[model samples]
Target: MRPTRRRATVQHTPAQQMLGAAEAMLRHALASGIVVPEAVVETVELACTHRRAGGEGELEPPTPALLRRLARAHAELVRLVAPATPRTILLLSHGRRSRLAMLGPVRLVRQMLVAVLVLLAAFVALSTTDYVNGTGGDILNSTGLSLLVNELFFLAAGGLGAAFSALFTAYRYIAEGTYDPKFESSYWLRFILGLMAGLLLPALVPLGADAEAEGISRPLLALLGGFSASVLYRILERLVGAVESLVRADSRELRAARRAADLAQASDRARLERLELVGHLRRLEQQARAGGTPDQLAEDLGRMVGTLLPVAPQDADDASDEHPQPLISPPAR
Candidate 1:
């Protein structure tokens, strides 16, 4: 009878098989622009070779090199693929509530300015009627002094109106978040326009002949206009508080949403890392069964788990084979 050749049968453990599959998938993904860790690639390669060599009965421990490679690969994989979870999102949202709070201040300033301006305008207009001339003539009594005083008061009122309008508009712009240093130049421009309006209002609105005879004085009219402007500005400030409160509430909601998104990304990353570690452990077991001794396997596993894992060189030099020269050269001669 002829002697029969015994064929070696290799059976990979469940963990080994699982790791092998995971590694293969990872490699394919990396080639397609997916970024997998080098450690993962090394572990997979070792597992595959061990399986092919027909030494799968015992669960062999991984070599130091294999373990180190796995650790690195898993770490890299987790970093590249994981994202945050929903709970984390909520936490992040809560952290940014302050940004939303700022909206309240913005709205409050707007309402106050409007109220103040209206009140001041009414006061200035009313004061224009109370002037007397130095000549003992009632400016309101059809005298030239009375007419001039009325005209001056009207002009002053107009200037005050323009000033209130400009200041109100500027306040609104600031509340709306449009405040800029460049806009300061507009302040002077608006002031000049207000002064011009004050000069022109008297010319535009005719005073009654009786008022001119009463002799209204210019100084009195100017004082009344100034007082009206001051009152208007104060009223505006008070009215804007409610608007600022509403803005604050809205801003808080926005901050909450942003925080939630960030948390989600972080959670995802952590989960991926755990999965990657499990995969690496499976690969280490597979590598040990192939041919490595227990010590060698443990060493490999340790190296794989270590912080720095060595990568396989793409262009490693091949070892040369040498044949010993015949001790006696006589045979060749």
Candidate 2:
């Protein structure tokens, strides 16, 4: 048998951990070309330097104020350069439970959203039970549950699909470490889209002889449409495109206008780039011409040549002769 190895258990004091975190943050800031604040410098100094007191050499422990300043600086730099940096670093640097405690509210809100979605799904399931079993009574009577239950049934199914989609999205982002509280509103929008898709799909794509033969139901189609709203959206987009295609003259005019705008934008961008190149050439020309190293001379010469060369135009219209290509094609009869 191979020799059994024991894992080393190395524990760090709070001060040492804070110092390490500070050092790590400062190193990250330096690597990212961010400015290190004075507080971080002080914290580093206090943590590293030993002072002689009572003839004993001991590190000048970092003060609370210094640590607080360091924490703020670290947080600011982390937010600017790498927002996805784990909260454990902040917790370590701050030496406080409250650093992670702030996320409690966000967690609670997500849980509440998930709970509401679950309830909605359960309610929808119960509401459709009789209908699915082919023992349905009047689905559109005057009672509160039946006033518009026929439409509400499909809409709720769609909402349930949206909820599942949202949950899946949240799971993906959380697993990938890219979840942010700021994008919660987008999930709400998705839910609304799901509801719309759920309601509209039944009307747009009817289940006739083929669907009955295949055992497809209207509500089931609505749920599927809600679950894949993007596909439903593409279907609607294609319908709109086909309608637009029927009016060839109007479509051609729209295309021409869009092309003209794009060409104008390209022309403006090219003019700005040329001006910038001219400015760079002028600055390089103004720099000292004497006693420069060979590497510096070569770099300057290369830049000058690069700035002076004629750049190929990005647009075909810009590169072609003065008689430009027609922006619009003749509308087909």
Candidate 3:
């Protein structure tokens, strides 16, 4: 029979276990560089409450201030333990995902405008061709449509097409996270005005011998008017794209500025932490001087200095003089 082997069990004090778990979670999150510190704090709070209640479910929730401080400390620890590279942060924040989200709508809008313009050009070219004689036989008459029906059909098609195009473009822009209220309003206004202009074009054209001789029937004129409206719609779409690009650029800059501000704040917090560490070391030094065995004094002094001094020359140079020297060069072991 195989000899029974016993599993070794390591024991920890309550405080040690709590701190160890918190530190482990924090380190893991920092190493991954994905989980935010707030998440860790939330987990810690939950764990602490569960533990305090002795597994009886009577634990009280942590106060808001306590949770906030825990989160702040967690973030500080991450920064101190595993600072992220600037390039990494930039890539994560403004890389392919962000760019796609910002510019996708703009591209779609541009394509829609191109399509509209092409359609308008074709319509305009066809309208310019002289197909009817002064006797009167145009595309509309060729189809046997009454004057009112032809005009109404052209107007309805033009208005509907323009409205649908505008709506589609707007929907795309909004979906891509490029929606701006002012721009949206302006675009709609331009679309409506363009539609009106398209409707007025037929009425605006002078009824002269040339118009009649050119073989331009009422339906053809109305179609030309609709084409004109589509042209205006295309122009407006392009303009919206331009404006949206500017807005997106501005938003990116603002986000970058905010990130920079966050980094500066983190640096400030780190500096304050260093100051606190120095103060703590000073107190330890004073206690050691007051009374302790030589060995104890030496150990305590070692720890205090270790906490104050930087592990690397670069760190030492970077460290403020007001702070205590760092403990032994971060132990190479």
Q: Highest TM-score: which candidate?
A: 2
- Residue pairs in steric clash, candidate 2? none
lDDT (tens digit, per residue) of candidate 1 on 45-154: 77667555656466665666655665555445544433422222222233236454342233222333453465467546645455533322223344665665555554
Tens digits of per-residue lDDT for model 2, 117-219: 6748755666755443322222332345433554667787777777678777766665443566668788778878888988778667745557756877767
Rank order by lDDT, top first?
2, 3, 1
* Top lDDT prediction, candidate number: 2
Per-residue alpha-carbon lDDT of model 3 for 95-150, expressed as tens digits? 33544544323433444466466656654554454542233333334444334343
Q: Each prediction's TM-score against the native?
A: 0.23, 0.43, 0.26
Question: What's the true lDDT of residue 22 in model 1?
Answer: 51
Off by over 4 Å in 1: 1-144, 205-333
RMSD of each: 47.7, 28.8, 39.1
Question: Can you give the lDDT of residue 197 in candidate 3?
Answer: 47
Q: Please give the lDDT score for candidate 1.
A: 0.52
Error of 1 at 319 (Å): 99
* Model 2 residue 34 distance off true place after TM-score fit, in angstroms: 24
Q: How does model 1 score by TM-score?
A: 0.23
